[model samples]
Target: MRTAVVSPKGDSKFLLQMRRGGLVKVYDSCLMAGSLYKSLLVSERTTAEEVVQLVLHCYNSSDRGSKYSLYEVCPIKSYERALHSNELPLRIQQNWPSPEHFCLPPQTESGGHT
Candidate 1:
């Protein structure tokens, strides 16, 4: 049987971007207690950088039985690119339809909805 596993670190980069954009915050009362996972779970203010740091800390501190690594969980290079560039990613642009393609058909004298 194939069991689905849910990960808390899935969107860590996106969250960091959101925090950098001023759309979220990285620290909170809960985070001061030193529970990284709990801080991430409860606060929408955590940044991507903070998440990356937490993941790294967890991965480095874990024993041999750990299932994943920081490199496997986070896209470090992509995040770095995003931090340096202002332009949207090519994938996002491709998904967005061109405005020219949405032009309305030339209207006739009869403007009835056929």
Candidate 2:
């Protein structure tokens, strides 16, 4: 397998995350948190960078995690890049698109079964 090796101690400026159905938290030396936040931003109607900063600030100031800095197993820059690309995950994409596009009735209607 391939691997990356840094100095005695690698960069520790990225370590926050929001798990599925779980609260968001920061890590000790993780950077992928930014990516997750970016994904979230894309899902919403907000800018990716704005969302990333909001999440990072929240994790830093909030008492959510165990206080270990919430290091990420991935890099935040990568996450940001992904978000900038406008390539959100399939789950998030589902939230978009009107029901009519899929042949579903409007919410006010009976929502007829297939």
Candidate 3:
């Protein structure tokens, strides 16, 4: 499996070639069904974290014969930096709620009631 970065300008493209009929299909963004490009070209402004998540989603969803060529839209280095950096925005981290937030409330004298 291979990963490609979606350009910051959102100008990346994807090219897929069929194994059986020797047909080549081109895509601009994720407009086609079952296309990885769709995963990358998310609605709203694309973020590095979103890109990574989409790429992983696509990779996991693909069958054995799925293969594609990603046109570099965002540089791979930028994605790497975003991934490694500890300064991600709070909104992005909010996707994974903190474990503390799921903790049960303290038990009252009634055992279950507050």
Candidate 4:
């Protein structure tokens, strides 16, 4: 395994992550809290798609990656939105007025991100 380098500004430098039948949280992206989140380093350049890949890498599985979606979640105001593949994680994070979190939750049965 390789070590992830953190920038002076504390941006995650990028490593990896994933989930099969579970969920993963990149904090400060929403209001939900759980034990699944740790510290994964991703920079301002990291995209929603790239984060999915990192999640898969960190999960050590190439299985059914499409079932997961990166979402900007805010439980307090009941706001949740799926992020575009090309959208920048940090860029979105930097624009939040209140506390929000990023989560790679499994898609709902209707093929929507939950």
Candidate 5:
């Protein structure tokens, strides 16, 4: 797959949204049954930390980006793993046999989904 770089220094256009199940929601976005997954267009070099920033950007959240955590979730395999701060999501995502998504929860590091 062709890779593209993403950065906070870049504009909002570089920021992508991933809506999987109930983990994320775009404010004022209309509900649609087939809109479960929206592709995230970050490069393989993009770190989990950067992805967190993107998620925060999506929510217009005022909280520190450090307060959130990103996880690679695969409902088909019935598995979810917390990604390291420096990990690359695109790399993990490429390994997915089927559609998967990153989970950004405030307390995932502490075993809390909320």
Candidate 6:
């Protein structure tokens, strides 16, 4: 049996890769599905006191026993800033066409064909 090399320090980087590599829809779905519970702990909607209970419930219901739910890892303001600052490792704009010369074809031909 062989194992692939993956650095623990690159967990977030791997996740970003997964997102860009066509896994974004499902990953975002999980995030959105669990967002309501996360939103409840957002700065003003609820107090810090309720965070733990809400997180525990969210963990049980959706996190599949993993402690990766955002609440436990995100109560601190600095962590939030760090999370927001996570830059995309890959640059994509270089592959797209510029809009300056953009054009569209006619909707129909003289023969009334699409």
Clashes in each model (backbone N, CA, C under 3 Å)? 2, 19, 5, 14, 0, 0
Ranked by lDDT, the better of candidates 3 and 5 is: 5
lDDT of 4 by residue, 1-114 (tens): 335555565665765433222222553222123444534566667777777677666656555545566777777667778888888766776667853343445343255542
- Stretches > 4 Å off in candidate 3: 1-39, 61-114
Stretches of candidate 6 exceeding 4 Å from the true structure: 1-45, 61-114
Model 1 RMSD vs true structure: 23.1
Better of 1 and 2 by lDDT: 2
The candidate that wins on lDDT is 4
Ranking by TM-score: 4, 5, 2, 3, 1, 6
lDDT score of residue 67 within candidate 1: 26
Candidate 5 residues 1-114, lDDT tens each?
334546765464364444231123111111123334333467667777877777657556676767767766655667767778898776766666654243333333345543
Model 5 steric clash pairs: none
Q: Which scores higher on lDDT, 2 or 4?
A: 4
Q: What is the C-alpha RMSD of each candidate to the true structure, in Å?
A: 23.1, 17.8, 20.3, 10.9, 9.9, 21.2
Distance from true location, Cα of 44 in model 6, Å: 2.5
Tell me the lDDT of model 1 at 50. Answer: 45
> 4 or 6, which is superior by lDDT?
4
Off by over 4 Å in 5: 1-38, 100-110
User: Residues 4-87, candidate 1, lDDT per residue (tens digit)?
Assistant: 445476664322222222121122212134532322231234433344345335446442212211111112332211211222
Which residue pairs overlap in candidate 6's backbone?
none
Candidate 2 lowest-lDDT run of ten:
99-108
TM-scores for all predictions: 0.21, 0.23, 0.21, 0.58, 0.56, 0.18
Q: In candidate 6, where is summed lDDT lowest over 10 consecutive residues?
A: 19-28
- Per-residue error for 50 in candidate 4, Å, reads 0.4
Give the per-residue Cα lDDT of candidate 3 at 76: 28
lDDT of 2 at 58: 49
lDDT of each: 0.27, 0.29, 0.29, 0.56, 0.54, 0.25
> What is the alpha-carbon lDDT for the whole of candidate 6?
0.25
